[model samples]
Target: EEEHTSCEIPRDAIDVCGVQDPDDVSLDNVKEVLDSIKVLFEEDKTIKAYRLWKKLEGLVGQYEEAPQEQELSDKLMNAKELITESMFMLNQVTMEAESVFALLEELDSEEGWELAKDEAGIRTWFKQPEGSPTYHIKIQGTIKSPIFDVLALVNEVDLYQKWIPTCDLSKAVLNISKFKRMIQLCMTPPSPVNWVVSRRELMLYGYGVDMMEDNKMIAMAKSPSPGE
Candidate 1:
């Protein structure tokens, strides 16, 4: 059987369709490319969109500040706005992806860790496959404050009693080095013991994470020093 195929035009073609003039310097191609990029971003192809945004940023720069060419100027401005919007969205997605990947990688590494305690934004874990006399505690969480603020709060020995509920007294005993300290903490338990005094060796280690540095503070106390 012989079949005939025919193209049908929509009823709204009169309102939506137009012929492109050869002399008109329009940004139709740029608009189409930007629209496709928007679709890619919507589909969670952020890396691709980001790459395109960087390329479009350069292309759009060429037509910028051309007052004599009003049409070209308008097209460039439109492209610039679109590029900016795409860049902002792509950056946000990139940040979210990084955060999620970091958390996932951490979880993957901690294959056998059991959640011991969860409070607010902090999570604590008890070490599995134990082999040492000292119990190891693994704490993992994200703080909304800047990393510097966290490091400062941890290293300030004088502020411990003010913030810690069990601490009766806190003092900086000695500054061994920039990354180490000897701190004294006195605690009064609910029992008959009047006071308990102890000294802790606080060691600080910092490592870079993206644009910021993450600090790890380790406090070790084997035997309590005599309090006079």
Candidate 2:
């Protein structure tokens, strides 16, 4: 005879496994989880794994099958596995999003950047951050057009090749919301460099918001975390 071990649910989570009225005890737990996930999602819209897991949890909770002790235990174990995977994925995405902001913060500081070019009303700086082989470049220039006009032009992805230097293609990969989207940009190096470098492609997640009170608009973008 083979011996089998049973999976046990924590006393607090027993209601979630259908041992008691889920609405009574589990509602608080569900709300807590949702609130935490909501905060994370708002901070980084790329965290979709938890939302997907929550939907699955709702479907499982609504199953018509009688909740036997063993069956409930099995369901709880499966849910635990799903929650673990979802949390791991969410954490990975959150870390990547934080790194993007961290780099931006570093760039905001004036200490490390060295002026590389200053001509034709355009200024450019370059920085070789510690531990990075590649150099980070920053270009600053004033556009003569109105902010709204510039924003409109940027939002028109098809017009990128016409005005953006070395741009070969630009298109939206996903329209996440009215103001947020994931885009793909392909840049070809100029002349002889193109033969040696080939075409480079970037996957960027970007958003634009109008600050009505400040009478200004802001647009930001960064490469999305993997699997996002």
lDDT of each: 0.51, 0.60
Tens digits of lDDT, candidate 2, 1-228: 955443332434423433222233232244334334433344333323234334546755654244657666665566555555455545644554455456557757788899999999999999998999999888888899897788788788777888889998999989875667888999999989877899999889886533333454456677775655
Clashes of 1: 0
All candidates: TM-score: 0.34, 0.54
Compose the digit string of candidate 1's lDDT tens values, residues 29-96: 55545554444445444444445555555555555633437667666767666656555454644553
Cand. 1 Cα-lDDT: 0.51
Residue 166, model 2: lDDT of 95
TM-score of 1: 0.34
Worst window of 10 by summed lDDT in candidate 1: 205-214
